[model samples]
Target: MESATLTRPPAGSPAPSGPTARLHVERWPLIGLVLLCAATVFGFFYYPTYPNYDSLYSMLWGRELLHGQPLSFEAYRAPTQHPLAIVFGAVLSLLGQDGDRVLIAITFVSFIVLVAGLYRLASRAFTPAVGLIAAGLLCTRFDFPFLAARGYIDIPFLAMVVWAAALEQEQRRRGTPVFALLALAALMRPEAWLIIGLYFLWCAYPASWSQRITYAAWTAAGPVIWALTDLAVTGDPMFSLTHTSGLAEELGRAKGLSAVPSSTIDFLVRLDKAPVAIIGILGFALAAYLVPRRIWMPTALFLIGLGTFVMVGVAGLSVIQRYLLVPSLMVMVFAAVALGGFTMLEAGRLRTVWAAVAILTVLGGVYYTTTRVNLHVFENELRFRGDSRNALEDLLDNPKVRAGISCGPVSVPNHKQIADVRWLLDLPKSQVIARTDETQVERARRGGVAIYAANRAVLMRTVLIDGMKDPIMTQPLPGFRFVAASDGYGAYVRC
Candidate 1:
């Protein structure tokens, strides 16, 4: 093989400088990026919106903790508790009625942080172009933004994991900071426990005995705190695990280990869409062939995330789509490489050809999205969430509804609206009942404030169970008389 000796610029004479240098120098400031993200969220996200069921439960639990009450994790259809989220909820609970919106705002910021972290990780692993493309793809994936807008804990958990990956990528074996981020993420999701444990092993190979001990402590922090919290409240160290499994069974979300392979492919396709998934696969193969070192960290993350998801199925936990988010994100990074990897190559005919292919792929993706994606449907769904929340609040605030509350508990069609009602009224778990609960149905029918869906949209979305399994849920109680109505809800009193 022919070889040529490489030499540096002589005596530091006129160091390399041009558009590329200026591009490096004029990087966006973190504060500026945050402000830009804030503006975008403010402009696009719906206002007067409440958190989703899981998040509202967090707020309610936080309020309970603030007022020195036990957490009602056993409440009908309550989601599994997340330690960091509860702490955050406790802080936001101080805001009273405004806490819900503030939680959404914080989630919006978490989404921004997630995007930023993805950009940083991708850029460090690949190039700036790839990083920007990956971040853009993530933003365009509506599921992620929807989760953030609804205040799902997954967004912040994702942010912390991505940032941890970024930090580790910036400097291999970056000890405490990366562990700290992963520890926080662990508090949010059990998946991070596996990640942090693996990371500890990687760090241990190069550390002193004391450093190993510290790393072990950080690795244990998430599960220990979680178990302790569960033990303290529910009197079972394994309450979260056992409770989540039972709830998954009740909700029909448990798919089992046999479904993992198919679920993995299905969820990836759902998150990244078919075209991106295909491109990401191709990109992974190509990067492995040409630049294994650069791709290794993201590849490790992809595998770990996939493994964690499979374990979730094995452990009989909820085998839902959100659990695949981290792997899907890594797929986005690979897909970006398929689009922008040409930038990393030296200027030549091969590079030109690859760049042309990338451009054509972009056009194809844009066409596919334009033809298949319905922006209006997404808009209306988000609008309904905000509108329904406001209407529910209005109904609860009605004079007759308040008077009926004094007479007896407030009852909803099912567990769907239980958290929302409790959060809105600051009512105890016992004070807001689901008609689906056979134990409460008799009491609800006797006397109380019964809330019903006021329109078709609300009826389908809130009152009816999945597949309209119970039509009677929307039927009016015999003795209840209509007292007041709002756009999406109707109030009746039996007192």
Candidate 2:
């Protein structure tokens, strides 16, 4: 059918032709849907590398769960723990162990579902075919697709949110399924609580009276269940508070100041990595401008989702582009509706516009992913290593080592300091050093931190400003070591 592109075509314009001319014809997304799924898989699983440090954090939570560290709480409040990603990791552990491979597989699978969910979400607003079109655009974006490549929670959470939204579009007979999904969403990440909670309230206020009440109750159940479970297991209402608190303090991020100019610029830089980000953004703006007042209510759903992310996001302790995860999900849905309403000429035109966006986004994203290789990212969760994991293995197997374990920071989640503690324990530190303060280093390694990890710049800054002393000894790590040392990550052994 010709798309409903322009709100008001010219008065004498031939009442649109081709697809729009054939109004009696119905549109379905059978083949388009299959292609959509494949496209997402192709786009997301570009790299089969190791889980980033954040992924390792979830792995660690499973370990803690194995060691009786309740689900609601952990000794270390790493970012990867609270969400449903932890539960998935724990379940993976239950099914005999294949650490890296299994975890990577989970990440890959999540992306496929993510594509399918977007398709379904789009199907609701326009023809099912238009939903497929939206998925095609989304999979093409570099920033949105990578979450799929590594099975990180951001993509999974986005998938769940999309599904929840799609389900919201349908008429429901019960609150059970609704509550269950919200719980699943919350299980993915604590931030989801805000999104789903708001979703529930909206469902109740001004909707069908009884239905609204039911939806609100369903939505409320997620946090309530989480709270009860936390109390039962960890004696805390909000789990991961301690670690999360420390992380926020370390980063010096304000409560709701997500609109920082530098950080916003950083996001624009990240967006520049892919044409898809830019493409989809333009498509969204154009589509929104085209929408007639008649479709305002339907469009309202997408706009609300977009507002939720834009309003609450942009300021999380995450990489600038990754923040695009939430906003991307919201906009993609709107884009589908926006794309669906196009006139055939407009649809074809949008197709061209979005195609360019997809291609650009993918190329840029891939280039960034392949080049610029460093394991020092303090915010990204998916950590890849060339020799680091192996070097760590060799050190842990040494006979001379006694109670040797290294500790260092990669990223902070749950206000928790440091990265990859899960990897730290499973992989053990031979002798660790941190570039942080004496206080932080001491707390992280109360068991006796021997060797230290620091960049030359970190040392100079601490020495120049803080007036702190030196490490008893210093060593190098990976590409460039800070100073002369015995082993990687500055393995300091007790004499």
Candidate 3:
């Protein structure tokens, strides 16, 4: 944590002075970038931030945990996501309100930590300029800032990965703290588990037989603990991994092992869309010729891990750009190494190229900050299809609607339908029934003959509910009368 310098001048030499001197020696640029990222996040939250279904699910899970409720939620809660939510929920419980503030705090702190970690890694592995470049580029990489603002589980997990990798050499001197951090990272995302495995594989090459086994054993603790925790939480040892696999299959994202070529192409294409990626790729391409041996293991892990992730589509996961953030950072480190070599070039032409790279990086940073910062406030309005679920909930003031049927219980329905019902109607998993099956539909109908409600979007999306396509309020089933309706929803009364 000492002040990072571009170089250490000779002892007894006059140290540099003034703003230019401070610019070369100080961490202020990194600080400035972090502040910019934080400001952008603040701008995003100035509006009512409503996250996607996963965020809502996490909050609900966390809220239940805070209330001392059992883990009775029907959906699979992955180990990587739930712990953070539970902690967030517990904190929210004490705060009385300000859940949004808590979310923003977690994300902003993680963003800052991630920036700091990247700077440290780049500084140690390459140079202060490289470190500064890497951090600055990350802040500007459009998705990076937004992802942090959204407060997903990835940023915190990535922060741990960055710090662990940065301090990896110190692992030998300081003991097994990096392993502990990696273990925690595994609890955040399964990618760290693979990284740990890959690290141990690299360690095995030069290590003595006993040393190799000890190191492997040390690395095994993370996955082993993860599996044990999964067993304890879900009663299935591999549920987190397996459940994700099944969900991916259901979502039609699973390609088994056959998706390697296309997934790799897709991953690369998506990666290139990030503004910082081109520079990182250029640096990595140059690193192949220059500084080939430096940080070779981390470089290989990034390639192999990413290639395998693309190929196998781990846990049947879809290719998300943010999933590659850690590997991207690795490439950025390699790029920094390349830049370091370029700066040391003997020829004027090569040095000019290095200067251009520096100039491009600085300009990119400015452009990213200037363009991405804007505050757009959206009203906290809840509209399910055309009907304002918010208005209906207020008008009805019915507690039973909390457990009432709206859209089908299964996830095949439009996500907004499920989320709206869960959020506005307060529907619990047990009371919900899948409308996909005639048996479930009949059962739900017979169980409650008084009223029925469903969102039209779900009806439109699924064939099973295609019977409910009337322009006006109309019964999709017999013994039901058209009662009232909203723009996106239809309500019915049983005769």
Q: Note each model's CA RMSD in angstroms.
A: 3.6, 8.3, 6.9
Candidate 1 lDDT score at position 487: 91
* Residue 494, candidate 2: alpha-carbon lDDT: 25
User: What would the per-residue lDDT of candidate 2 be over residues 323-406, giving only the tens digit for each residue?
Assistant: 445555545555444444343235466667755655565466568655763434521323323233434445435543324333
Per-model TM values vs. the true structure:
0.94, 0.64, 0.70
Candidate 1 per-residue lDDT, tens place, 131-249, comes to 88898899889899888878899999999999999888777899999999999999999999999999999999989999999999999999999999999999999999999999888
Kindly indicate the candidate among 1 and 3 with the higher TM-score.
1
lDDT of 3: 0.54
Candidate 3, residues 1-495: lDDT per residue as tens digits? 111222332112333689887677675664676576667565555533433445555565566566666554344322234454555555654653355346656766787888878877666554566677667656645466556655666788888887877776323322256666776776666677777776777667877888777777768776787677567667887766677666565545535556656655466445434444565677766655544433453565477557647644544655555566667667656555544535434457766787787777657756774786442211222122123434334423444332233432322122233433444434454444334334455554553322224554434433224243332222345554455444444444342
The candidate scoring highest on TM-score is 1
Q: What is the lDDT of residue 432 in candidate 3?
A: 40
Stretches off by above 4 angstroms in model 2 are: 1-48, 69-77, 80-83, 95-97, 170-179, 205-217, 228-246, 253-255, 258-324, 333-387, 398-492
Candidate 2 C-alpha error for residue 255, in Å: 5.6
TM-score of 1: 0.94
Model 2 global lDDT (CA atoms, 0 to 1): 0.49
Candidate 3 clashing pairs, residues 3+ apart or interchain: 386-487, 386-488, 387-488
lDDT of each: 0.86, 0.49, 0.54
